[model samples]
Target: MKKETIKAGQITIDFLLEAADTNGAAAMFEFTVPAGAKTPLPHYHEHYDETIYGLSGVLTFTVDGKITDINPGETCFIPRGVVHGFDNLKQNDAKGLTIITPALLGPVFFREVADIVNQPGTPDLKKLGMVMAKHGLVPVVPKR
Candidate 1:
């Protein structure tokens, strides 16, 4: 088991534990989003399920065209193939935890995002899309 604390985008991601290297089934993370931080574009994986538990503040999630605001102690689940995304909607930091099942790709994907966000210059969205696609993640275009 390995534990790591890293910053990704505007969030601090703490890899509370990982089962990818051994069990190949699950991974857990403690995530914190600074005020005003927005998550990545809405996307879905073909074979992984994700669950988020809100620890504090408000989490605004846009899932399958519906918007819901989850408060502290609330939890939301995104089944495989369902498009979902979230943002920290409070004036102060928002803290949460995420658990992913069938952990094959999700952990690697998060690590990549952290790497990209730390690189200088504006990120190339198209390239990022391609990277995401390669990992079975499909990015959805949000409604205008």
Candidate 2:
């Protein structure tokens, strides 16, 4: 099957190995984060662990209130239920490979999110939250 690419805002995700390819064991994808783009909402997965391997540039990740910059050739493991978010604050785009266990999330989730995110004007937070919740990603609201 042909791989699918989903674009949500300034980020592009190419689905490399989906749940079908992995028999539900895992799903792998490559993502690109453009420089200067707004960071994704901090969120946590309640059902699957995620591992990210940096490919180029740097992906600055905030996990459970701790910030870390994952540079090329480095990796970060995010256990389930750990609130995490990332951004490409460098001058160049950051690329990476991500693998999630149990393959619970696939193109459908991203597609749904992309639809909401790519819409004209500001996206509806309530709808986005609903989609994320349906996919087991719980958004984290920052404390003032």
Candidate 3:
């Protein structure tokens, strides 16, 4: 049981268990977002289903065309192919555990994002998006 911490933009990800270490069955990570932090753009995982369990504060999750407020101790799921994303909109920070099944791309995506953002200079948005695309994520256009 090895753990890794990765910084992606304004989020801190603690890899609890990687799918690769589990034969591609599942991956889990603890995510912490600071107050007023930025969030992943709206997107969908082409091959993995994600389940998120709130651990502290509040997080706003958007799936399909709906938005739900996830509070402490609550959980939600987004099936593969659903347009989804989340943000911490509360005055305090938010933390949660996210699990991805079928483990197709979760670990890779986090690693790439962390690498890109932790580099010497500013992170290239286009490059990050390309990396995400290669790992089976489709970024959705944000609503106006």
Candidate 4:
């Protein structure tokens, strides 16, 4: 019944509502990724599917080993267990909305990442990986 706004990483996250907390699902969100900002390294969830709709500017998404450019009105679906990550590649910030199905632990994941980003000192990649693992997330290693 209430909305929340969080400034994390290079994005200002506006959470609309908790769609299904008991089921770990959330509704739409206004995600603003600042220019030149990149999301966390490619990662995947074993039980969640993420769909992204770009609202403004351009978003570069790297899924598996291929890269795709998404602009306003564009959409991309990332199936469960697929490695995916994105970044704002334009001079202006990119705005988008992402929906995760079966929610899984996505909300928890976002909060954790926000905490790490706000912590002092450079983020420790290894520790972050551990934190992600606790929520069934696995980082995708680039192909050789």
Candidate 5:
């Protein structure tokens, strides 16, 4: 199957399978975040669970305000409504597989984010916020 690719901030996301095809059961993707990349700000999903399985390099995750470092073969789960975010904190590349359960609107949000940031000008944060809201992705903290 052909994969959908998106550049969300400092990372490249390869959507292997979207939840749309799975009837909102799950969405899967492999993501590569460059060294020192700042990941998305802390946020929580109102209706879906998210999991990140480490595939390569180091990823520092902040889950519910607690920081933890994830290495290869490791996994972290963020239950629905739990605030969390992550970043590639090492000097090498960081890669992981992300899976969202009951994956309603995650793909749409990422696609929109890629489009907004890849354009020739400054991305519209207000527009992005609307998209998040539309998808039930509620950001508890401001983007850092």
Candidate 6:
């Protein structure tokens, strides 16, 4: 399988291992979240669990209404169906490695997101939601 490096909006993801390379056991990737970058919205994955290990700097995560800071050597586990989002609130960039069990998500999802978000005009949130839904990621919609 080809290992791909993708720039998805404010983050860069380097795919290390994919489903085809691991017999569908897991998909692993390294990611860099630039300073001041935040996830567009909290989302939940219904088909897989994700574990993130911090490599450098600090990354702040909000999971199910709780906030946690992951520094170098620290880890965070987001279980399937749990709403979670992350951001780099520090002055420096944050690096992390993530593994998704069952290998349900891959580069394609990020690539699609990059395409939408990188467009010249404002991204269509509805279209973005559709892409996320296609990959089993359901973005949380804010209630009035």
Top TM-score hit = 2
Against the hidden true structure, what lDDT does model 6 obtain?
0.92
Mind giving the per-residue lDDT tens digits that candidate 6 earns over 39-82? Answer: 67888999999999999999998989899999999999999999
Question: Lowest-lDDT window of 10 residues in candidate 1?
Answer: 102-111
Better of 3 and 4 by lDDT: 3
Rate residue 98 of model 5 by lDDT: 91
- Name the 10 consecutive residues with the lowest summed lDDT in model 6: 1-10
lDDT of 2 by residue, 114-143 (tens): 898899999999999999999999999887
Query: lDDT for every model?
Result: 0.80, 0.92, 0.87, 0.77, 0.84, 0.92
In candidate 3, stretches whose alpha carbon ends up further than 4 angstroms from where it belongs are 119-122
Residue lDDT tens for model 4, 1-144: 326777767777877545465355545566888899857778888877878898998889988768988899999998988889888877998888887676565455567778887777787788788888987789887667
Better of 1 and 4 by TM-score: 1
TM-scores vs. true structure, each candidate: 0.88, 0.97, 0.91, 0.85, 0.90, 0.95
Off by over 4 Å in 4: 19-26
Worst 10 residues of 4 by lDDT: 17-26
Which of the two, 1 or 2, has more lDDT? 2
lDDT of 5 by residue, 1-144 (tens): 647888887789888878668887888888999999867767899988989999999989898888988899999999999899888879999999999887675567788887777777777878877778888888776556
Tens digit of per-residue lDDT, candidate 1, span 25-121: 8878878888898578898988888888888888888888789887889988989999898887779888888888877564566677777776788
Model 3 C-alpha lDDT per residue in residues 1-144, reported as the tens digit of each score: 438887887899888887667798988898999999978889998888999999999999999989998999999999999999888888999999988897775656788888887777778889889998998898898968
